[model samples]
Target: MSRIPPIKITPIKLIIPAMFALTLFPVFYKIEAQDLKLPQCQDEEIVNTVVDFFISESVWSAYGESKIKEMINSSIHTANLTLKNSCVPMRRQSGKLYQVDMTIQAFDPDLASYRNQLLRVTEPTIIKEITQKPNHYYALVVDDLPDDILGKTDVYLDPQFLILSDQAEKYTLEHELGHLANAWHDDTSWNSSLSKYLEEYTPDAHKNELHAYARGYNCAGRRTIMSQSSVYYLQLPIYSSPDIFFGDETCGDHEHADNARQLREYARRLKDKMKNNV
Candidate 1:
């Protein structure tokens, strides 16, 4: 009988490169709900809403899964308060609930680079995706966001994704969600005009440097969640009402009331669209 060559067994060391490639190249990794250990809430309706959690390998390596989950849970609780109190009721009247589908990804190379990619390359795709569907939103949580912006929502270009910094405060997520729901900046009309004029007139390279001055001079001084000023007033008590202008009655402004009306109208429009799709 002819000698048969022993079959070669691949060394484990040789296989590692392929494994590493597989791990590095995948677009995203799904995180199971059990892994999150999500904080329980009394309201089953809010709890029932699906949340799809995702984290980049880089983020997981840096923050660890536990820390990431903790941060996300905290944000979710804040968001739930806003949604349950404010958004859901309006949505329910239309025979539909406000459903949120959020995807959080970590930036590679650097957070700033990712921000540039979002603004330049991916924004169009994101806008198309969100407009084609209803009740879907995306958020990117990163170690660093633009120095001037703690959180921002571009409703026209990328309504799905809000860029949030890691150091974002308790109400920041809720504030960005307000934008996703069609709420404009607390002082959008006046502040935008003034800011634009300053940008045109000022020769300084740093345009946002004068933003605070512009806001102070022209803003209506609202205390709503959408206000740029609200971040400074975190001492105010939280309320369990559907109004975006719920806290600090003394600081209320007509803009807050207008925003509430806008929110309701936005919800009604979403409901009508959902009905039409069906």
Candidate 2:
């Protein structure tokens, strides 16, 4: 098995390679109430999440079971830490500390053939087949993802499935999870503005030089983890708070995506469902 490059300490800009292949198209389905019960956190300030990950044959061959397990644990840890500090309800808004308690399980199946089907066809045919259980959120860890698409969330179809590339950055998994929690991208509507800012403020000589997207600091930089991976070099693992504008004090008072609020609201809905046995 050919080895993939180790994850960088600072994630690089996302670029899609034609040779690499993975397909996840938009589709919708009625979500069935999961048979697998989420742990109750109704009176408490926590979201009990269970992540079931399917390891592709390529990943299994490259990293083996032990290393794959380590990667999953590390990803979950990063998610937990990010939510703890960045979530407004958890950290700043309320005195109570709201958080997500996440656990992961690894599954090994004939995913090589399944992936081949995806490349050959458009329909997500075999996802339900290999899922060993119901209710727990599911993910497929493939060797590579195409189209600059590091991850894809199945929020509309089942709201329980995600497709992730093993080659993506460390926080890619968390980014997808944020989507599951109803978080939106922080870079929305800033594409043209960012491009213009870079062209105007960035010196022509230094324009080619790579830089992070910080807004107030140097008229360029990122405050939220939901920003595109291309602008992620200097960003901390934090979400946009709903109570404040995305650009903060220095930048314009444009409305941010408010990922923190979305996550908290999603958690609240989940807790209520659990409490009501819905």
Residue-wise lDDT of candidate 2 within 111-211, one digit each (tens)? 34333333333223333432332324656677645535667764433455566776655566667766655454544445565466457554464344212
Q: On residues 1-278, what C-alpha lDDT tens digit does candidate 1 reach at each position? A: 44323222211111000000000011112222222111122332221222222233344457764566566666666555444443443321111111111222443334344444433423245435544656555455555444445566545444445656656665566566555554544344756654664556434542332332111111223233455543343321121122333222332334333444444444555666666865
| TM-score of each model, paired residue for residue | 0.51, 0.54
Number of the predicted model whose TM-score against the real structure is largest: 2
Which candidate number has the best lDDT? Answer: 2
lDDT of each: 0.40, 0.45
Off by over 4 Å in 1: 1-56, 85-132, 188-223, 235-251, 254-257
Pull out the clashing pairs in model 1. Answer: 138-160
Q: Model 1: how far is 53 from its true place, Å?
A: 5.1
